[model samples]
Structures are given as C-alpha cells and as structure tokens.
Target: MTVETPPERPPLTSVDQVNLSDWDFWARPMADRERAFALLRERETPVFFAEPVVTYATPGEGYHAIVRHADVLAISRRPDVFSSGQGGATNIPDMPPEFTEYFGSMINMDDPRHARLRRIVSRAFTPKMIQKFEDDVRVAAAKIVDDLLETGPGCDFVTEVAARLPLKIICDMMGIPERDYRFVFDRSNIILGASDTEYVPADSVDGIVGALLTAGMELQQLVQDLAAHREANPTGDLISSLVNANIDGERLTMQELGSFFILLVVAGNETTRNAISHGLHLLTREPEQKARWLADVDGLAPTAVEEIVRLASPVNYMRRKVTQDIELNGTRYRAGEKAVMFYWSANRDRAVFADPDRFDITRHPNPHVGFGGPGPHFCLGAHLARREITVMFRELLTRVPRIEAGRPERLFSNFINGIKHLPCDF
Candidate 1:
C-alpha cells in the first residue's frame, strides 16, 4: 500500500502542522483544501498531526490524514487494524461514550456488532425492495421535473430540486408522516451542521454543545415515538421492518432503532442531496460535459454518476483508530493513534484517476471512495444513492433542457461538503 511520494518541500513548520486540524482551515473554499492537500500529498503522503479541539468533544492527539489512493484503499480494506470502534467515526476528538453510541449508528462499531446490525438492516433493502425503490425514484424524479417546469425558469435548486428527492424517498421509505418531514430535515441539518454558524451560532464551547445536545434530543425523542407507534401498528416500510426484524431471535432495541433512524436520515439524505447539488454545479461549470451528457443521459448515467460522486466526495473523511503499533510507508503509528482517510483527496489522486482534476463524465475504472472504501463499512445505501442521482439528472436534463445552476452557497464545515443553496434557472 506504499506510494512513491514526491520530494519533500521545505519541512512544514509547527504552525503549518497546526493548521491541518483547525476548523477555520476547512471553512476555506474548496480550492483552498485542494491546494493544501496537494501540498501535503506531495511532501507528506501520510502526515501525522493532532486534531483541533472542538466545542463538542474532548481534545486529544488527532490522526494521520491518509491522502493517497493506495493507502486509503488499504486502510479501508483492513478495518481490523484501522478500527472505527476504538475511536468515534468522525475525525473530531472523542465525545462521551453514551453520546457516541447514541449517534454513531453501526458505523462507529467494529466486527460482530456492526455485522449483526448490518444483517438485520440488509433484509429491509432486498432486491425486491430495491427495485421498488428505483421505481419510486423515477416517479419522484418525474414529479420534481414537472414541478420545476411549472414554477421555473428560476429557483433555488438546492431547495426546490436537488434536496427534494432524497428527503421524500427517505421519509416514504421510513413511513414518516408528511407533516414531520420538515422537522426531520431541520434536525438532521442541525446535527450535521453543528460546526456551522448557521446551525450553531455560539462563540463559546458551552453554547455550541448546548445547541447540539438540544438537536440530538429532539431527533431521538421523535424516533422513539415513531418506533413505539410502528410496534403497535406496523406498515410496509423500513421502520416497520426494523421494528420486527429478527435474526436468530434477536431484534433491534429501541436505542439501536433510534440511532439507525438518525443514520439513515443523515447519511441516506445528505450524501445523495449533496451529490445531486454538486452534479448541477459541475454541469453548469462545464457546459461541454453537460452537453455530452444531455445528448444521452440514460446512456451516460453509469459513468456520469460515478464522476459526480467522485467530484462531490460529499462525506469528506471518516476516522479510524490504530489497533496497535504499525508503520505505513515510512511513517510509524502507535497503537490508539487515529487515521483520517481523506476520500476527497484520494478520489483526485493521480495514481488512480487520469487527469484527476478534470470533470470527465465518461470516466472509466472509477474506483472512487465516494461511497467509501471496501470493508464491512462500505455504504449500504450506495446502490440506492446512485439510482436516485442517475434518475434525477436524467429527468432534469431530458425534461428541462435549458436549466442551469448558478454559484452555490456552500455549507461551512470540514465534515460534509454540503451546498446550502444554489440559484438556478431554466
């Protein structure tokens, strides 16, 4: 898994190393991150540094940012060594154990626990269910296009278009009431957007922590209520399936159900919504590429979807803990140290992608880590996310041929590459 590193530039100073973990560093424009990671990749393929202490978690020695594609893939494959359970899922410092378990879903668990939960949840998304989901996606896409056609030539694409499909699909799949969609959407945004001022406008640690706790509590209460209702009156949705799911006489506890719901709402919704938003932005920026795709969206979808995922890299990074002392390439990592796989950087690594920076909708051999690397942790929703993105774009391009997106109002965070809003015209 070793990569040939470029010759080191003048060694990074203490100040330069410190910036790597600072939230302000991530809040900079996407291009800034590109330049920073490029410099690190060339001079220090696997750099070790401490994470900046955020208001929500206790400060501690941080992680090694795995920037190369080979290293990222290798680490992702060997989940036993680079364990998620030892630390939390995000690159942030550790939170209270209860908080981590309540919010981390199966993602933060290792081995048997992750395996058991995945198995139960997997049953709900069987081939038959996925086919139905795909059909539902197409119908949702068509309806979205029709609405946009009636209301546009102009709208906020993030709100009016890109964000709608995932939200609707997830709510319907979970059997959530239509009235609760806005509440679920808001809470999910707050949870993911904790670092952003728009969601948590606090200068002090206590204020930020308070906001986050409040949001988490509300979401948890809602899910718990829903679980109780589903238990009493089951329906043909994911919640009901999870409510009654049995594997060797084992079923999900109320706590596990709540966490799974949170994960589904955030991961299932945010990843695809951001990808669709970024896809519109990419196409608008590269009309030539847009034209090529518009010429045959259905034909180009397989590759186009991969390109969008790669370029978006919506979920920026996931943290892993070193199970024991190890050396990667020339860098030595001790047991309990953290490794943050920068999928955003790996997707653009020259070793894997040709003309890595270019937006090529027809890219082949696109083994992007956008869904995540191989392992038990690879995204369960990957196929569904792809279908949603493919169908939505196909419908938009085919039906609203003249539609275009303007500059995005980006989300301010290091964890998620989110687009808060995008002005668009048809």
Candidate 2:
C-alpha cells in the first residue's frame, strides 16, 4: 500500500505549519499544544496532515484536519458521507483484521450494523440503570473524597481521585470482582498510555504495538471468561445485561462482547478520568471560576460540565473515510480519503463560541462538540460522564474546599488528551 500525504499546492502562510503527524508534536506539553493549534487555525481552518509510516502498519495517505466547528458538525451529522466503519476511528492507519475487529466497538461501525449493536447496548443504559449508576457514582465519589481526606490531600490526584470514581463504577457495572480492580486499571492504562514511556517503555514502534496488543488481549480474555460465567449464571450487572441482551433474537457475538468490554474499559474509564483531571487543573489555574463553581455547584454544574468537556475534549479526534467524491467548502476530497474531526479545535472555534478560549462555567448556548457533534456516533456514555464529573466535583469541593492541583503530567499520545499524573494538596 502507498503511504503519502495529501498533495499540497498552497503557499506557506505561517511558521507553525508543523505536521501534526509527528509524534513529537503530540508529546509536547499542553501549553505548546495550544500554540500549535492556534497556528494551524490561523493558517488554514482545515488542512491535511500526512501520517508517518510505522513498522507495524503502513499509514495510507493522511487525512484532512477539520478544525472549524461548522465543518466538524457537518461531517459528524452526515455519517453516510464520512463513515467510521470505512477507516478505523483513530487517525492512525489501518491495523490487522484481528486487531481492528477486536478493538473497534460500535463506534467503528456504520449504520444498520452500528444501529443493531447500539440498540442492544442501549438496553443496558435504561433510565433505571442510569439512576442506579447515579447512586453508585454519588457513593463512589464520596468514598473517593473521604479516602483523599484521610490521606490528607497530598496525593497524585489523577490516580487517587480523578481515576477512582469512574474506574470503580465501570468495574462494578461489569460485575468485575474487587480483586481485579487494580488489574483492570493497569491494563487500561497500558492500553491507552502505550505511547507514553511512563506507562510502557518507548522502545520501538513494534514494542509499543506489542504492549498494546498484549494489554488488549489480557483484558479481552478477562471479559471472555466473565462472559462465559455470566452465560451460565446471570447477574444483576451491565455485563449480564449485555450478555443476555437481544434485539429480534439477535445477541452479541463473543467478539462483539469482547470489543464492547474493551470500549467500556478504555473509553468509559479513560474519558471521564481525563475530564476530571483537567477539571481540577482548570479550576486551579482559574481560581475565580473555582470560587464561582463552589458558590453554586448544583445550579451551575450542568453548564460547568459542558465547559469542562469542551475544554478537555478527552478524545481528541476520530477518523472517518470519505465514501464518495465530495467538496467540503472549496477542497475536493475523493472516495477513500480520510478526514479527522479535531474536537479539541472545534470546541475552540471563534466562529461558534464567543471568547472561545475563555473558561467560563456560565457559558450558555454552548454548542460545543465536546461529546461529539449530533449524529449517530455521538458518545454513548455522555450522560453518565457528565453525572460522574458533576458528582465527583461536588463531593471534592464540598469536602476539600482548599484543594490545590499542580501542573498536569500529560500523556504522550495524539489519541487521548490524558493526564498521567497530577499532584494535589489541600
């Protein structure tokens, strides 16, 4: 297969036209990321960034980087044209069939198939299930804060607090035994943080891929064993619900179940953890906003969560393949071409948001594509994520009002906007 960047025939207008495909760009500190995106936004709203070739898989011609809010929304709304099932959701090039099918969840499937899988999974998130989840979230949040209080505030907030609530809740929902909590957490970190040397050694591209696959397989095996047990004996948990769930006598195949489990483990656990981590860091950076939030967390929390997600954009960009020749604005894209929706940029688009860079908890009419734009592929756990953040912050601020967070140790990957470690003191 050919590996190349889109043919560029435009004069350079800015010095910051750095290729986003460079791993160094993603590994940069958060402050540098802002400057990079700002430069890209100024030079071109939607520009193409060629992906670098890798040892394990060859990245095909790179994707169109859609930065404008309108363009991201337009593409998201038209799944028929921009199909996730065509290309893997991540900006990275194609992987082996086993890896793709085993790792990709419903988010990677187009309609019909996507609808079928989503419908079954949707059954697991009924109103009753959600209420129970909320109750669990409140309890988990309280316990997490209580533990932090006992620890007397000087701790890695990312590991101790931000990662606690969601990981516990997700594990409990899956009926994972308490003994396996640490195992689940470790595997998740390895899966998402493989690109970071702190999580997995930065030995080589193949080594990194090996570690990721090993982590994924370990988690996949765990779920498979659990699914087998659940088959023989049903339980009152989301895993059981998914295991027994059927639509028109359709049930999730073992592979689908495994993929779904991985999705929940990675997406369900990682996204909220990163969001909570960023929330605390943001509050620490802007004490005025923190004070405002403390004043009325309940009244302002609904919008506050939106703002956090808008700013955090934990899952940065998702890839889609063009199904047919189409012209987006003035750029012509052919069939099989790729487009990456930069949620991090779209959330900061000046055209849609006034003072888009400002962190305002009271920002209303927030049409940010933080949870992704309105489309069939919109985040499935968005409601749960919001509730988790709201309740977790409410508990933290109410109990540890003087909490202070240090600079975040960001993850070294373009895929997830993650914080590996965050020091905090109250």
Candidate 3:
C-alpha cells in the first residue's frame, strides 16, 4: 500500500492565491498552509470564500475566514450572536436533514436546547468521573506500550499506539464490550475519514454520504442496543447514566442518545489520537523539545500536552453562523452569514504568542483554543483528552524514550488535521 504524495503548490505570496474552501488547499503541505494563513491574518479583516460543494448538501453562501486569535475568542464567547445551531458548527454548509439525524448533538444546537443536553451529559465528564477512569487510562497506556514493545519497531504508531487508548477509553466509558471495539473503530474512521480513500473506498457503492450514513447507522444501532440493555440492567457506565435519567430527572431520548454517542465516539476518539500522533511527530522533528520533555516528563506533561495540541490543532476549524448583524474587532458580519473560526490558524497567530510557530513545551500561559474556543460549545471531553495525551506520552517517553515517528500519512480533510498512519521505530 503506497501513499500518494500531493503535488507541489505554488508559494502563497498573496491572500488571493489561497482558497480556504478548496479541498486542494487542505492537501497542500503544512508549511504552505501556514504561509497561506499568515497572508490571511495580515489582512485587516477576515477573508470570505465560497463554500465547498458537497454531494450530500447544497453549499450555502460563503463564510468569512476568522483566522486571528482575538476574532476566534470573540466569536466563541458570543454564542448568542455566533450560533452553532443555525447550520452546524462542524461544517460550512447548513447540515442537511439527513446529516443532522445522525450528527446533530449538542455541539450543533443552541440554548436552551444546547444547555439542557450539555447539562445532562456533563455529569459523565465531571472531574470525579474523569478521575475514576485515571487508573484505567494508566493500565490501558501501559498495555499499549507493552504491545508496541512485543510487536517491536516499525509499527504503525497511529494504529498500534495513538489510536488505541482513546478508542478503548471512550468505548469502556460507554460500556462497549471488547468484541465491538473494532466495530466502533472502523465506523469512526468512515465518519471522520470519509474523504480519505483508505477508510471509505472511492469505489464504494454509495460514495461519501452513503458510507457516512451507513457508518452512522451502524454506530447508532450498536449504542441503541447497548442503551436498551443498560436501561433494563443499569450499570455505572455513561450509557446507563444517560439512558436512565439524572438526579434532575433528565434523560436522553433514543434519538438524542444515538446522536450523542456518535459525537462522543467520533470527536473523542479522532481528536485525541491525532494529537498524540502529532505530538510524537513533533518530538521527532524537534529533538531538542523532545529532550526537554524527557528531562522532566512528569513535571512538564501538562505544558507538553498543551503545546502539542496547540501546534497540532487536531480538529482544525469549526464553523459558526451569525445570528444577527454583529461587529467583531471592526469586521462586520451580517445575519445568516457564516464564520469559519480557524482554530489551527489562531493557534499560530503572532499577536498572542511570541514566536507562535515554535513548538516549545515550556510555553507558559498557553491559552491555545485547541479544544475549540471558550464557550458553551467548548470541548466536553477536554479533561479526558488532556489526561489521555499526558498518560500516553508519559508511558511512551518513560518506557520507550527513544521512540521516533516516521513520515505521517496525513488525512485529506479540512475539518480534521489528522495523520491516518504514522510509522514508528526506536
């Protein structure tokens, strides 16, 4: 299985040379993306581009490319004005009704609906709940490392190591049996990596949307079946808690549970895996930074995990819709307009961090919005994500300190800055 390298792109000398909505833009090298975003940030106001046409839905009006840190922060904080519910925060086009059936969770909703759903689900992600899983995370990471060692070097790190921890943790939290782990994993790949030929084959029967819907339906069914069982014979797992009703007597409907499960597995699994993969790649590229972290893995794990996330910006840009005519940092956005908050670009903005492109683990006051911006829609699984990254790296560096990542097989998706495969050796 050979990886096809993307063709060389011309240097982005001007903002006009770039198109945020183009699929080819995302296929460009990371340096080219950096330069292209830098040119956009140089402009006084956000640049607008036409929406990418998808087979599943019609492209709405183009969106403003909100690339700067301040602008992203402003838009994220003002959820009332910049709504995720109008269309959906995950994609540029208004989510088609079919897409929403499987994909529409709280992240795609507004208050009081968003707030209500979040309130119900937030219990599972509380500090106490996350702490309960801390031992499980350690045991999981150790076993993964043990397998990596037994398998020896030249393994696909993304699959053998990075992808396993998050997948297992999320599944375990939901009471998914070990027999169904691969079932959940494959479907997640299709849902997020649909554009990549590796996951949803280009020669498939129904194409991207069909593959997505099929995958979504499979995952929803798996969770629904589990939810039905959990409801009757309740367990301490998240699925049981969600299905049974909280102290407030609020419980998720079957449809809500299905959508939320999809969101949880997809978002929770994919983002953290990419972050871990990117962290290893970053450390490999910057050996000095790697050594710096190695010098004090336990002490610097928090900052190191954060810096990796900041640089990786795993989930990339999230789209928001303007609810009213609003002026943010002198740029005016009209009602019903779309604003794509490029968290990846904002993480590299010069205004906020000194030498923003540098991957320094000691980056103090690291206020990067890798987990989306600070608002109601901020990443629900953030604490778990941080813990996962930290534990995985700690286990790796302490046990396999010399491990290094080879060339990454990057995922060809604008929404996710993902490495589908990463070769590793020590």
Q: Which candidate is the best by lDDT?
A: 3
Better of 1 and 3 by lDDT: 3
TM-score, prediction 2: 0.94
All models: lDDT?
0.82, 0.83, 0.92
TM-scores for every predicted model: 0.93, 0.94, 0.98
Residue 420 error, candidate 1, Å? 0.5
RMSD of each: 5.1, 4.3, 1.7
In model 2, how large is the Cα lDDT of residue 142? 96
Spell out the clash pairs found in candidate 3. none
The order by descending TM-score is 3, 2, 1
Clashes of each: 0, 0, 0
lDDT of 2 by residue, 1-426 (tens): 111223433433454456778766675556666766766766544778787555457788888888778888889988988898875776468655757655778888899999999988986666666777887889899999889989886799999999988899989999999899899999899888776776776555557677778888888888889989998799998778878887799999888998888998889899999999999998999999999999997999999999999999999988889999988766677898888888998888887889988899999989888788889988888878888999999998888999989978888778889999999988
Q: Candidate 3, residues 351-379: lDDT per residue as tens digits? A: 99999999999999999999999889999
Error of 3 at 284 (Å): 0.5
